[model samples]
Target chain A: MSVQPQTQARTRRTWLRVFLIIPFIVLLYPPFYNSNDPTFIGMPFLYWFPLLWILLTAILTGALYFLGA
Target chain B: MFTFNPVAFTVFIIFFLIVTGMGFIAARWRRGDLDQINEWGLAGRRFGTTVTWFLLGGDLYTAYTFIAVPAAMFGLGVLNGWFAVPYTILVYPIIFILMPKFWSVCKQRGYVTAADFVKDRFGSRTLAFAIALTGIIATLPYIALQMFGIQVSLAALGIPLSVSIGGLQIELPLLIAFLILAAYTYTSGLRAPAMIAMVKDIMIFIVLIALLIVLPAKLGGFGAIFAAVAKKHAASPTTFFEFLSPKQNWAFVSLALGSALALFLYPHSLTGVLSSNSKNVVKRNTALLPIYSLMLGLLALTGYMAIAAGIKPPKSLGANYAMPLLINAQFPPWFAGFAFAAISIGALVPAAVMSIAAANLFTRNIYKEYISPNASERAESTVAKWASFVLKFGAVLFIIYIPTAQVINFQLLGGIWILQTLPAVFLGLYTNWFNRWALLIGWFVAEVLGTILFSAAGLKSVYAISIFGVSFPAMYTAFSMIILNLILAIVLTPIFNVIGLGRGRDITVATDYDAEEVLPVEAGREALG
Candidate 1:
């Protein structure tokens, strides 16, 4: 096994996995987008913000899976 | 309260018949020998990505989402309701990391249940037995909840909740619906739900999108609908809010996190995952399944739409009827039939999967292990088929004999109870470093403490509590007990080691966990041949 290159690829995938958890953590922090400002097509940011992140996280996961991580 | 709307009833009967036909025919969808437990119980472990997506999305997001999410919001706003958005969003990422490994190892070991994995990994039948009993016990109420969902929809469709015959007042509609679900599930096994889910999900998405478009227009715009919600919340700020109140932040976070963790631990969810053919299918689903979460978000808003349309649930049914009542109020009679059928079909899919999953646990861990260790695969499959019916009837008995309030409470306890197995099942996926005895002790402590805390809190289904002179904010009893459970598992590991209690040999190697190759069903069958 090529130790150095394998470690580099493993770390890259680990970072990608960490990216997956970001949206989960972000949506849980209520203070960030808990207000009714920044509405999207009449939905309060409170609702639309997390809804948007659901897709964003999905995109990130799709990327990670295809990347063979 | 019951008006005979001929159009709605006819349309409902039409869609209901269509799905029922789909269920019976699904037995031949992928003609496998149903004699083997693996073939019958887990769809022969042969589902590809798209099928797995529909099956899991249909299985995990139940009538609970269709009725309860909107109803909760209509009744109590953000804390009670909208937490599901975060819960669903958080669920995938967690599963993305955890479930593929679970699929991989379970496939390699031919493990049908988490208890199977626990018994093999930890070398303890007692621990495996603990996990199986908990899965079945937690699942009975969950299956009953889905029955209750169908009952609510039936009640909305103008069927009486009960009919008296020969001094016997029976819940005729629910019993009839449960029988249909039981018959198909017993015959078709997991394939029944996987096939019917394709139709149920389509109807649900259609009903959801049609309502999202039509209800907003009828009730003015989303802005107007929310403004009415705002007005109501403005009047009673304590009960309803667009955002979480400061006091509710912990409750919201813990409820969302605890539920996200517990979602996959449910045997029904595992049945959906293990039915898939590959790690890649499970991984692909992590990306695709959020379509339901988006639908859940849109559907939850219908509660506010119900309010804006000035629809009121009957005082008898309470707030859980909010969405069903809103459906009847807002939609034309024919379309209302389709919507009601969507909700009721939604109930059948998960109810079938739940009973099969529980029955899989019962047959594999209980009967095959204890009753007849030398039982043939065909006999095991037979037991699973019969047990699925009996387990489902147990759920039916729950609905008939138990109050709906208590059933919902039991469902909440189900969430708490399943999370107790996290250390043994989820954590053990990575390492068997923790002693099995200590892990069982952790599970026992959490189960007893969680139940005691829950009961001590009275009829309130979920709550937070103080531990050792420190008061945590009001949150789910499950989340709090899980913290204590984790602490005990961690602390007791070293002590148990010092006392020379063996953790048993790790039967699973790293390569078992690292099996990422997808084996399609033909190759799997040839291997069997």
Candidate 2:
């Protein structure tokens, strides 16, 4: 439960760097992937895109909290 | 084409007046040190989880979502409607990480606005001023969009454009509404709107859920509606059921990303964070708020249902009345009046909070930092009150002067401009690598390019594009600007750092990011009080 200030600082930096890369990945991907159908969970990939973001956000926040970043 | 029923209009006005009266009485509720900007602008930063939830919900889900999303779906089909779901989902997590840190820093330093944090953290008033100006300018169009929402609802209700009083013709609906909003926001500060938000949000939930259930059943069911929409898209072969072309796809993705980044950067969202009683509240809400997105998805579908029901929007007024028209046609007069009230009340709450948030930025960053530097808390609060009033008035003017359709387009344009502020905001939360000058340069580049591209695309009318000899509507321009912004920000960060442009000492020491078990006295009070 206790973290040194320096360790905590380094962890925070790592997490920030990780999160900053996500938008780029999500943004750069094409609408439809050749290997996958355009549907995700019975809706078109386009329709599910925002829902994807919702999940992405939750995972990222959980990571940051667990990692103590 | 759109006419307001006199009986419905009278009822609407009476209800609004009652709410306004209640809002005014709320001024004395949960009294705090009204002299302080935090007290006035942020409700003394004392809102617990329940209050914070309603405040943020009310603030974020404006008339824009309640009316505009369904309207966009009705007019433009799936593309624009998609924005609603993504925006709500994206904003929560983005704020989750950024907001807690911001809250800590602001609490540590007694910062009331995002501009305050920027000023103190960077020790540069110029950078702070730029951020403040951007928040206010960007928020103006957004507030105007809310007014547009109210106007559309009123038009749908058949309210006449002007009312004559003893041979004196007056065009005063928008003006009257704005004045009422300005009064209570000034009187009760954040709390006035925060309390009102509870009722507003509950009404929205009830209305939306009732419509979602009843509308589908009334319009030959969901299966029938989807079939109609699919048939319509197939017939057109140009607008619906088609992904953006490659060029447009880039724009779509970029706009979404840029907006996601810029969203929490808005002063009002930050005010919500600062007002929360604890970091846990922020975290919990990140998970909880997505429930609204679920509701939004249902709301978006109502547009397709409107189309399926064969309810044509009034030609003179713009398609924003699609929801109201559909509801009016399907329901009886009293229930339709209730729906109109839901949308109107929805617009009022966020507009009030946004004006208050922007005014707080002006007071804390512009007035106190630059104007007096030694201004008292009372002086800061007074300035914020007047600034909020002026902001609401300016929004009314924006609605009156600009064509409704053009104003809606400008709101999209404003999204592009606001998205440019991401690096200075979201990135600044946990890193010091980005120099202030680089952020400024990135923001300027994004704005200029976004404006040019959006305009060059001719406001992206009707999603027209040719893929292998087939065409579709254009929805790619705004997204393109976002890409250019990111590249510029990323590319310029190291360059500016290498050249030492706007590179100051790192004010965020490592210890600042840590979540403490034993909170400091002020932070503890801020979280628990």
Candidate 3:
């Protein structure tokens, strides 16, 4: 019975690691975020999206750490 | 000849002296036997998360970065400069994955330099020597650029960098500052820079905060600043870019990806990681270090602020002067002096760390391996201290005598040369199935061919390749060479193994890569010394 929970915990940890790839997928492909229509304040989507991701990435990394990833 | 500003000079000197004092006092901070190489060079691997975060930030985001990145944005535009944003953002994820494993292995087996780890893992002294030589050579031009950072700061403050003494022109202020840096590094070793980095980061944060708040309000807003950039881009469409042009997309993505891969591979960056006490410390820092990346991205926008404010630097100084000139024009003299001092101190921290890192590689891989086979820990540390001093002095002389353009050209090549080691260092972390000789040949081929490609592109780092009468869009030369390097290593590894030429031994166990920290050996030895 205990072995089943151990495997479940291990599998959950592995899935958490996959979330780390979100920033790379979103930021690395410039064509996806390279638009001007979605301007936050006055900054372009190209500029503000990457800047916003810096915070979101940090929060994600921190979450991964706290969740025992 | 130089327009002197007394208030600025005085403020700069005061901050400089404070850090100089801190440099000396840092030797006593976390008491250890300064005679041991690990103790002197890696701060006995004792730093917690906060110190490691500051040290790596100060080491990686250098003084040249402050002058050059904004200068690129102010002079050119997004594709030329702002790729650094994505580049820095991408670095943390890579670090989060790789550095904790690296830290664990190094801590378990007592590896001081990346070359030291490569030497043991591959069991080829020749391969290790190649890595050590590449690291030392690549770092020299980088150190020279740090001195260039100080020169720009002083020049901006209206302080003369050189003075005619007797018949020879001497860069007096720079020489004096370097001497102080060398003295502290020699006496305190890595501890000096580690401690000073904290102060440098705080000062830089203050400068960044002040600039972000003041510059935007004065020059309308982010919208106006970027609109001004668009207007200028329209005026000279070919020279400036408000965003990556269709043709520039490949180059932009390649540079960001390539540079993020290369940043931690540099020996100085590894030194910062190795100095931390635990794998968790290194891991936590990846989450924290993006604060500086955020600051750097905002700082890049000051280039657009320069445009909106209509601050024109002297034509001779070019766009490198744009940030300094903007600071001079907009801020009070006292604040300007404070900012220049922050930049100059910023240069000293990285310059000290790079020299120590290069020195550590020489002492561990070259001098100990070749010259003195059984040198004591005290002897190794002693040699490293002197080597760090000599390396910094040589860099100062090189910058003073060599033309700045020549130094800049070599620094451009330094990035390409250093990235070729990625196959051996980064990939070797995961698998040692690669034959050592194959890795060496791959490195050699990449170095020679990359240099040729860089030159063919007229000394530019980005190049368009034509193969079989088909042309591809320009990409970072380093990225293309690294791909070639990996292919060569992969193909030749099997051929070499088939011939029974693979004699490499792995001294490190698999568990070493995940081993949690033990109390450092130096802790017990501290009282004996």
Best by DockQ: 1
Superposed Cα deviation of residue B57, candidate 2 (Å) = 0.8
Report the C-alpha displacement of residue B191, candidate 2, in angstroms.
0.6
TM-score between candidate 1 and the true structure:
0.96
lDDT of each: 0.88, 0.72, 0.87
Error of 3 at B429 (Å): 1.2
Judge candidate 3 against the unseen true structure and give its global Cα lDDT, from 0 to 1. Answer: 0.87
Q: Look at candidate 1 and tell me the lDDT of residue B347.
A: 88
Runs of candidate 2 with Cα error greater than 4 angstroms are A1-69, B1-7, B164-169, B240-248, B460-479, B482-502, B506-508, B515-529
Q: B-chain TM-score, every candidate?
A: 0.96, 0.90, 0.96
**What does candidate 3's lDDT look like per residue over A1-69, in tens digits?**
879976787688778988888888888788888777688878888888888888888888888877867
Model 1 DockQ reads: 0.77
lDDT of 2 at B382: 93
Candidate 1 lDDT, B1-529, residue by residue in tens: 6465889989998999999988999889878998888988998898887788889989999977988889888988988889899999999999999998899899999999999999988888989999999999999999998998988888888977899989999888788888888899888999999998999999999999999889888887888988889887998888777678888888888898999999999999999999988888888899999999999988999998988988777787777888888888777899988999999999899999999999999999999889999999989999999999999999999888887757677888899999998998999899888888888898999999888888988945457566699877898877888888899999998999999997777788888886847355444344222
